[model samples]
Every structure is written in structure tokens, then in C-alpha cells.
Target: MIRRRYIDGRYGQVHLRENTPLGEPPLVCLHATAYSSRSFSALLAVLDGKRHVIALDTPGYGESDAPDGRIGIEAYAESIAEVCPDRFELFGYHTGVSIAAEIAIGHAARVDRLTFMGIPHFRALDFAAWRSKLAARHVLGERLDQFEERWRFFVSERAARLPLGRAFENFVDELKAWPHGWWAHDALFEHDLLARLEQVRQPTTVLNPPGHLAEPSRRAAAAMPDATVIELPEMPGPALDLYADTIASLLLAKQFVGGAVPA
Candidate 1:
């Protein structure tokens, strides 16, 4: 059963809801910056029926508190380590992908596998430059034109006035930031795991969305010999069940994330 409880209540804290007795090592799922664990409630429930699934409200998102005012991706990963210290698997979507990558690498012993869904590793920049770049709108084709129209609608005039930190963050990030504390856009954007994929000792899996991020994400996954790239037909929303059976089988068989099959 999924029950919410606070864990690691320091500067930053998280609300963890998990099933403790699935008789399996937990699959710790981290939602993207704008999202909370609620997004995975459906999929988690299904997976939980077979094996335990642990999802937490990252500091500054969901019901969690952001510690020390502002935080970066590293600190977010650190929070997970403190709360869920046992060995487990890591899964993330979009921005969560970056965090999970470092989490697995930062505490290699704790992570068995690292999975990224809709790997959106979009780079961040100074607000002014960011806007100018967006305005330039490099037209790749009709597809990009359609995307640009949608993105344009997403960014309103008032949003342009928000502080760089606030602008970079979505609903979750804003919630985590202290009421009157400085924001921390610099910390999270400065580093990404694509360049450091080789450092991740855990077996990596990247299932990308059908868009610009796919090609590069696929290349990044290739950095590790143990990595696997699973492509799916274009669809909307998260692909939570694309390989759920395989993941479960791999875990039950003790085929750890280092890409080794069970004995």
C-alpha cells in the first residue's frame, strides 16, 4: 500500500509513499522538475503489485520542502540517498533523467540500474540569451514550426519577468524554493550526465521520446557498453510500461544493472 510519510527532514525533505513488502528491492522513481510522484501513481501501482516501487517528492516539488532556500540537481540526488539509503533501481523522466544519472553515479553502490524516460536534456542559458535564442527559432521543418507554436504559447509575457531561477523551474521547483530565499538555476543546469555517462557504473537504459532529444540521448546511452536503447513508436505521455515485464524479469533474476545476467 502507498502511504505518505516525511523522511530526511533537514533543509530539504521529501514525502515518500511506498509499498514495503513487495519482496523485492525498491525501484525508486523520481519525477521531472515540473512533475511530482503523482504522475507515476498509475504505473507505480501496477509495478508495485509485482515488486516494491518507491517514489518521493523531491525537495521543491510535491509535498517536500526545499532546504537551504535553493538547491541544484546534486542536492536533490543527495536527498534521495539520505531517505532511501538501501540498494535499489533509479528511474526518471525528462529533468529527472539528469538527476537519476548522477544519483546512480554518485552512489554507485546504492543503484542497481538507471532508466531514463523521455530524456529531455535541453540546455539552459542566461534568460536574455535564452529568449533571443527562442526568438530566432531555427526552422528545422514543419514539425519544428508546429512545436514552436506550442512552445510560444507556453511562455507568456509575465513569465519573462520572473527571476532566472524561477523561470527555469516549473511548478515543482517553485514549490520547493523557500518563500523568500534566492533561487538556484545555476546549480542544476551547470552539469548534465550525457557527458559523464561513462562514469556511471550502473547499467543504463534510455527510452527516448520521438523528437530532437532522441538522437543525442541515444548517442549518450551508447557511451556505456552495458547501456540499452529501446525505441518505441511515437506516442503521447510517458511510456511507463514499454518494458515493464523485462525490467521485472531482469530484477527478479538478479540481473543487476551492471549488465550481468543472473547466475
Candidate 2:
């Protein structure tokens, strides 16, 4: 079974959802912006007996305490790293990809291998446009209808590929992040992820699920020294609940080959 706990971090208490029954180095997971470690709930369950996994709530996003203000990607990486094992594999999704890359680069000795589900490799102009759009759209207002509108948007747009209940779960996670949720995006757009990815020396796997980031993930992979792109054409969304088994299998296969598990 997956379990939850809190650990000391640079920010205060960092929350984690983990399954530690397996006898292997843990797979440290990081989630996308506005979401939390809860995003990996399904995946944690899937890998419960087979692999040790720990998913962290990025500071200010989940049960973790929010930072004093907007911090850079390096800060996010460092804070999360404070709670991670001395050595392990890493997995990241969306904005987590940026943070994971930074962690792998900064803490190279600790991270053995890397896996990324989405890479946000936007051009300078594109990055600015995205920040502008998110800033204008993600404001939390006092009106109740504004909140309803956000809910409807998630149901129809952001989490369309998920079931109604699953979509609602995501929506709730997004709400929990509130005003600081946008901080991750701010740091993401400002980070030179390509440069950081190039500096990552670990073997990396980029899962290319059908999404806006597919092409960009490939572009980002090319910058890395040892990275492979695996296409998941059937996965239209990054809902871990729906694709946990598939994701776990791919990760396990890589781990086995990399000697993360007994051959």
C-alpha cells in the first residue's frame, strides 16, 4: 500500500507519498505544476510491491509548506532533494521535468538515472507568451462563479482525458496550490532547461505520450548526452491512474537493464 509522511526540508516540512516494500533504490517522483505528489497515487499503488517509490509534494503545492515567495527551479530542486534518498532513480512530469533536470544536474552523484514524461522546451518568445497567459488566467478571485468556471475548465480542457472523478481529484489538487501554484511556471519559463539537460550525465528516458510536449520533449532529449525517447501513442494524457501499469513496466525495464534491480 502507498503511505504518506512528512520530512524535514529547507522550507519546513516536505510531504511524501511512498511505497517502500521493495528491496531496491527508490524511484523519486516529482509532479507537474499546480499538482502534488497525489498525482502519482495510482502509480504508487501499481508499484507497491515491485519497486520502492517516493513521490514528493513540491513546496507550496501539496501538504508541504509554501516558500516565502517565488523561488527559482534550483531552489525547488534543492528543497526537494533535502528529503530524497542519498541515491535513487528519478522520474518527473511536465514542470517536474524542469526540476528533475536541475536536480540531476546539481546532485549528479545522488541521481542514478532519469525519466521524464514531459519537457517544456519553449522558445524565448513562447515562454514569455505562456507566462503571460498563465498569469492572466490563473488568478484566484473572490467570486464563487470564478471558481466554478475554473472547475468546468479542468473538466473540459485540462483533465479531459481523465474520468470525471479523476478529473475532480486533479482539480482539487490544483486548487490547493492557489496563488503560489503559478510560481512553478514562473520558475520553469525562466530556467534554461536545455542547458541543464545537457549537463545531466545520467542515462535518461523520455516518455513521449501524445500531448503538446511530445515534440518539445524530443527536442530536449537531443540536448542530453544519453537519453532515449519512448513513444506512448495510446496515452493521450498524463493521468497516472490510467497508465500506471504501462509506466511502471517501462521504468522497471529500464531499471533492470541499468542494474537498479537484480538480474
Candidate 3:
């Protein structure tokens, strides 16, 4: 069973969802922007007995305390590292990828390896446009119609393949972090991600699912010194929930071959 708890962190309290069946070094997970650790519930369930896993809600999201003001990706990485084990492999999805990369670069001794579901590599102009567009969507006191429009956009474009219930759960997570949902994106676009990826010397795996991020993820992987790309064209929309077993098997196999421990 997955258990939830909180630990003192840089911001105040950091909420964590953990499943620890064995005593091996844990695999720490970080979720995408606006979403919480709950996004990894399905993934954690599949890896329950096979490997110990802990998924954290990035500061300012889920039950974790919000920061005093907007911070950069490095701050996000530091806050997350403050609550992580001294040594462990890391897995990140979307926005979490940026934070994970920063951690691997800044806290090299702590992170053993890295796994990213999507690594966004956008041009300066493109990123700026995207930041502006997303910021507009997240207006604090937007009209109900605007909110509904955003909801419909998420369901149709982002969560099209997700089951109704699962999609709704994700949407609710977005709502819960509505006020600061754009903060991570702001930090992400401002960071020198490609340079940081190049600095990450840890063994890395990039899982590329079919979507807008697929090409960018491939390009980002090319810059990393030690990285492998696993294309998941067949798995679309929320691979954590849809392809949990596959992902779990791959992660276990990697750790076993690396002499970490047998899953």
C-alpha cells in the first residue's frame, strides 16, 4: 500500500507519497507542473513490491507549502533535494525533468541516475510565446467561461487518451494549484536547460512518448553526456497510468544491470 507523510523542508513541509516494500535505495519521483505526486499513484502501485519508490509534490503544489514568491528551477531543485534521501535514482515527468536535471547538476553526489519522461527543448522565441500563452490561461480571477474553456482544452488536447475519471483527477490537481501553476513554467523557460543537461554525467534514460514533446525530448537527450532514449510511440497520454507495468519493468532492469539491486 502507498503511504502519505510530510517532512520538514526548505519551504516548511514537504508532502510525500511512498511505497517501501524492500530496503534498497529508493527511486524518487517528481511530477509535472500544477500536478501533484498523486499523478504517480498508478506507477507506484506497479512498482510497489518490486522497488521502493517515493514521489514528492514539488513545493507550492499538493500539500507542500508554497514558496514566498516565484522561484527559479534551481530553487525548485534545491527545495526538492532538501527532502530527498542522501542517495537515490531520480525520475521526473515534464516540468519535473527540469528540476531533476538541476538537482543532478547541482547535487551530483546524491543522485545516482536520472530518468525523464519529457525534456522540453524550446527556442527562445518559442518559449517566450508559450510562457505568455500559458500565463494568460491562468489568470487569477478569470470568468467561469474562460475556466471551462481551459478545462475543455485540457480534456481534449492534453488528456484525450486518459480515462474520464483519471483525466478528471488530473484536472482537479490543476485546479488545486491554479494560483501558482504557472510558476514552474516561468522558471523552466528561464533556465539554461540544454547546458544543464550537458553537465549531467549520471547514467540517464529519456522516455519519449508520442506527443508535442517527443521531438524536443530526443533533441535534449542528444546533448546529455550519458543518456539513452526509449521511444514509447504506442503509449500516449499519461504513460505513468497507462503503461505503468512497462515503465516499472524497464526501470527495474536498468537498476539491476547497473548493480544497484535485484528487483
Candidate 4:
């Protein structure tokens, strides 16, 4: 069962959902922007007894307290790291990838392995476009209809499998975290991912699922000193929900028995 808990950390109270098995090195998961640790619901369900799996809500992005100022990726990394075990593995997606990479680089001894999906590779020019979109999404008119409109548009794009009620709840989760959502995007824009990846010493796995983020994962795999790239040619959104088992297999094979070339 996934249990929700709070940790008083440097920033403030950090909320996390976890399924911990006794004596195993924990698998700490970080989520994408606009989403919380709830993004790993499916994965956690499947991984419940397999290992110790902990999914953290990035500060200001879930039930966690917001930082005093707009912080960079390093601060985000520090927040998550403060709540983790002395030795653990990492799973990160999109914005989470930036934070995870920073942690693995700076605290190499604490992380046994690193896994990333939807690794972002953005150039300086992309920030303008991102800022425009962020501005549009940051609609806080204090009108219920406006929130509903935003919720519908978001659900139409990603949560088709979810029922309307559950989807709306998830959308509200996004809305409640809106103030900090754009902060993650800005941090990603400023992050030097290549420089960070070069410093990662743990064994790494990059999931190359077809999407805007796939090519970046490919680039990231090449940059890592010891890394394995898994080619998953499915649409990223649905594939992420359905392929938790596939990822579990990789983690088990690599970290438990023996690592091998992905078949």
C-alpha cells in the first residue's frame, strides 16, 4: 500500500507517497512539472512489494510547502535529497530528470543507480516560447469556470483513460500547484544538463520512448559515462502509464541479478 507522509526538511514540510519493503535500497521517484508524486500511481501499484519505492512531491508542486523564492534545480535537488535514505536509486521524468541528475552528480556515493525518462534538451531560444505558454496557463481569474476550462483542456490531452471525476481531481492537483509550476520550467531552462550529466558516476538508464523528449534522452545517454539506453518506440504519454512493468524489469535485471544489454 502507498502511504503518504510528511518530512520536515530545510525548505519546509515535504510530502511523499511511498511503499517501502524492509531492508531494500529505496527507489526514489521525482515527477514532471505540473504533476505531483501521484504521477507514479500506476508504477507504485505494481512495485508495492517488489522494493522500497518512494515518490516525492517536488516542493511547491504537491502538498509540500513552497520555497521562499524562485529556486533553481540545485535547490529542488536538495529538497528531495534531504528526505531520502543514505543509499537509494532514482527514477525521474522530464523536470524531475534535471533534479535527479543534479543529486546523482553532487551526491554520487548516495545514489546506487539513476534512471531517467523524458530527459529535456532545450536551447536558449526555447525559453521565450515556454514563457509565453506559461503565461497563458497561469490563468488565475478566481472564476470557477476558468479553472474548469483549463482542467478540460489538460484532461483532453493526457488523461483520457481516467474517468471525469478522477481526472478532474488530478487537474485540481495541477491547479493548486500552479504558482510553482512555472518555476520548474524556468529552472529547467537555466540548467546545464550536459555539464551535470558528465559528473554523474552511478550506472544510468535512459528510457528512449518516442516523443519530444526521446531525442533528448538519446543525447543524454551519449553524454553519460556509464549508461544504457532502452529504445521504447511507443507514444510517451500512454506508454509511461502502461510500461511500469517494463521499467521494473530493467531495474530488477540490472540491480538485482546482473546487468545485461537490454533485449
Candidate 5:
């Protein structure tokens, strides 16, 4: 179920969804651009009974209000700080990983464990090329074959289970509109995480998504001096189950039920 809340310093009443809110020390989920936490529903089910999977519709997406352009990853991190959990585990997918990285690095004391899905950051690939693809100027015409090639990977497998016609249309509508300047704050991602690598202290599991994104991410994990890397394939089984096995192992390895968070 979802609840509307006003986290101080937040843009407005934040819309947060809790999956059976089992208890404190919840597993928190952060989603990518053009996605609400709802996107993770298919993955949340298999996370096991130990976690109270909670998803937030980051401001400017879904039911949440748009934060002012002045906001940065740190601001979103700060908004996340308001979550009154006895303890918390951070899980971020794709663009969400960028935020999780900032939070885990900046507010190390707040996070107990970290999980990053589709980590597009800390890669050898040049950001300039990535930015070019995201540029609206690159897709102003009808003959945009280049963009479609990549956009297909973004489709959900659950689309087949949905009514298809209307549900798919509504799914498109839920994506947060890309307003100018509300995107990737370079300064937020600018700091070299390598500098404070050891400071992460908490166990981190970087799980690449179930597709082509996994290869480069596997390379990224190999380079991380301290992370555990796991690749989940798109086939062989349901995507979420693979994620569950990876995370369960990480938690068991760390033996981190963590400690009590402040009230």
C-alpha cells in the first residue's frame, strides 16, 4: 500500500509505497528515471520474508511532487534521511544507483547495506556518448531509428501480463517528465568514489540487470576494490528470483542484520 507523507526539506508530501510493511529495518528501493518504485514490483515479491520492501516515488515522479531544480543527489539523499526506520538497507536500480552511491558515500552512517542494480556509474565508458543518446536534440525527427534500438530494452516483461492496451499507456504516463535541468547533477556524481572506497564499510552487492547491461557491469565489479559482483541473466528463470538469491547471499555473508537506527 502507498501513503503520502511530508518529509521535512522535501519538495512536498512524498508518496511512499510499502509492501506489507513487515517491520523496521526495511529494505528501501530507489528507481531510475522515467520510473516510479512501482517498476520494481515484479522484483520485490521474491525478496524473502525477512525484508519489508519499501519503495519511494522520488520527487518529480509518480505521485510525488517535483523537487526544485536546486536539488541534487544530496538533497534526495537528505529526503531519504527522514525515513524513520530502526535500520535500513538501500537498493537502487540504474539511475537509482547514482543516488544510492551518493548516499552510501555521503551518509555512510545511515546505510547498513547497499545494493545497486544496473549500475551505469563507475564505468570506463565515456559519459559524453551516453549524454548524446539522452539528448532531445538527437531525437527530434520521425526517422529516429537509433533511439528505438535502445528503448526496447527498457520494456517490462510484465507487459504481457497486463491488459496491454490501457495499462501500457498508463505506464508511459507515470514516467516523470524530463524537465530541463532536473536531471543528473554532475557535481553530485563528480566526486571520485575510489578516493573513499574503504569508507563504504557496509557490504555492497552490485547486481547487473538481466540483460546486455550486465557485461560492462561485470567489468565494473571486477574493478571495484571492495564490491561483490553478481550477474542475473534475463532468461533461465524469473528476473526477480535471481536478484533475491544474490541479495540473500550478500546479507548472509555480511551477517548484517545491522543495528538499531535512531528514532
Candidate 6:
């Protein structure tokens, strides 16, 4: 069973969902842009009953309150670091990938292992254009129709596999983070992804799913001090939800040895 709770984070109240709340060296999971810890509900259920997993609703995304002013990846990492234990395994998808990398680099002593999907890489020119686009989109309009248009587009492109009710819920979550919804992407595009990855010293795994476009993830994996890259070409589309069993197995192998993390 998943339990809901809150942490009085430095920036604001941070919400979390956990499978095994008291299990040690928990697997700290982060979600992509506009999504919450709820994204990992299916994966949490598949893990063994004794294996602890905590999914954080990153600040400005879900139930958590938005930070003051614009912040970078470092700030986002610090927000999570404040709540994490002395050492834990980290897992993330999309935007969460960059956050996980930042945490590993800045708080190496606190992170034992890392796993991520989609390491974002952007050319200077591309980032400049994206920044302008995101800046314009961040301002939510007054029209309900405009909101509906954006919601429909997001659902069709990203959440098609989800049930209608769940997809709507995601759309609502997106609406809640408006004005700051683009903060994470902006931070990611502005940072040097390769440079950041090079700083991470922990044993890491890059989980590549077919149909996902992320050349940077492969490059980052190759640059890490100790890393493993696993490409699941046959398992396509949002690997986190569709291939929860495969991912859970991988973590179980690396982090769960005799019901505990290896020393």
C-alpha cells in the first residue's frame, strides 16, 4: 500500500508517496515535468513488500509549493537532498534524470547509486530558441479554451496510454504548476548536461527504452565513472509504467542484495 505524507522542505511543503515507508536506504524516485510521484504508483506496487521506495512530488509540480523566483538544477537538487537520508539509491525519468544527476554530483556522500532515463542534451542554438518558447508558454491565459487546447495536446502526445480519468488528472496537475511549470525545463536547457554527468561518481545505470529520443543519455552513460547502460529496444513507450517489472528487477539486482543494499 502506498502512503502519503509531507516533509517541511527548505523551500516549502514537499509531498511524498512511499511503498515501504520505513525500509532503509530507500529508492528515491523522481518524476518528469508536470507529473508527480504518483507517476511511479505502478512500479512501486511491483517491488517486493519489504523494499522501500519513496517517490517525491518535486516542488512546483504536484502538492508541493513552488519555490520563490527562478531556480536552477542545483536548487532543485538541494530541495530533494534536504529530505533524503544519509545514503540512498536514486531513480528518475526525463526531467527527474537531470535532478538525480545533480544530486549525485553535489551530494555524493548521500547517494549510493543512480538510475535515470533520458539525459537531456541541447545545443546552444536549440536552447536559446527553446527558452524563448518556454517563456511565452509559461504565462497561463485567462481563457478556459486555451487551457483545454494545451491539455488536449499534452494528453495526446504523452499520456495516451493512460486511462481517460488519469490523463485528465495529469492535465490538471499541469495546470496547477503554471507560470512555474517551465522552470525545470528551463534549468535543464541552461545547464551543461555532459559536464554535470562527468561530476557524478556513484555507480549509475542508464535505462534506455525504445522510441525514446535521448542521445545525451547514452553519451552521459559512457562518461560516468562507474556506469551501466541497458537499452530495452523491444519494450517501447514510457518504459517506467510499461516495463515496471523489468526496471524493478534491475534495481532488485543492484540495490537489493539479501534484502539490503551491499556494503
Cα lDDT of candidate 6 equals 0.79
- Point out the higher-scoring one by lDDT: 2 or 5: 2
Off by over 4 Å in 1: 123-186, 238-263
- Winner on lDDT between 1 and 4 is 4
- Model 2: lowest-lDDT 10 consecutive positions: 254-263
lDDT of 2: 0.85
What local lDDT does model 3 show for residue 157? 60
* Model 2 C-alpha lDDT per residue in residues 101-217, reported as the tens digit of each score: 989988889999999987888762376677786544466678777677668767767654578877787788878988567888888888889888899999999999887778888
Report how far off residue 115 is in candidate 4 (Å): 0.3
Candidate 6: residue 91 lDDT (0-100): 94
> Residues 1-263, candidate 4, lDDT per residue (tens digit)?
88999999887899999985658788899998877888787788777887788999899888888888688999999888988999999998989999999999878899999888887775423646765664343646666775665666667655446556656656877787764567787777778987888888888888787876677778777888998898988545545566778877766666654446444
What lDDT score is found at residue 221 in candidate 2?
95
TM-score of each: 0.68, 0.93, 0.92, 0.89, 0.70, 0.89
Error of 3 at 158 (Å): 6.1
Give the Cα error of residue 255 in candidate 5, in Å.
Answer: 6.0
Candidate 2 has a TM-score of 0.93
Q: Model-by-model lDDT, in order?
A: 0.60, 0.85, 0.85, 0.79, 0.58, 0.79
Give RMSD to native, each candidate. 9.5, 2.4, 2.3, 2.7, 6.0, 3.2
Give the clashing pairs for model 1: 11-67, 12-67, 60-176, 203-257
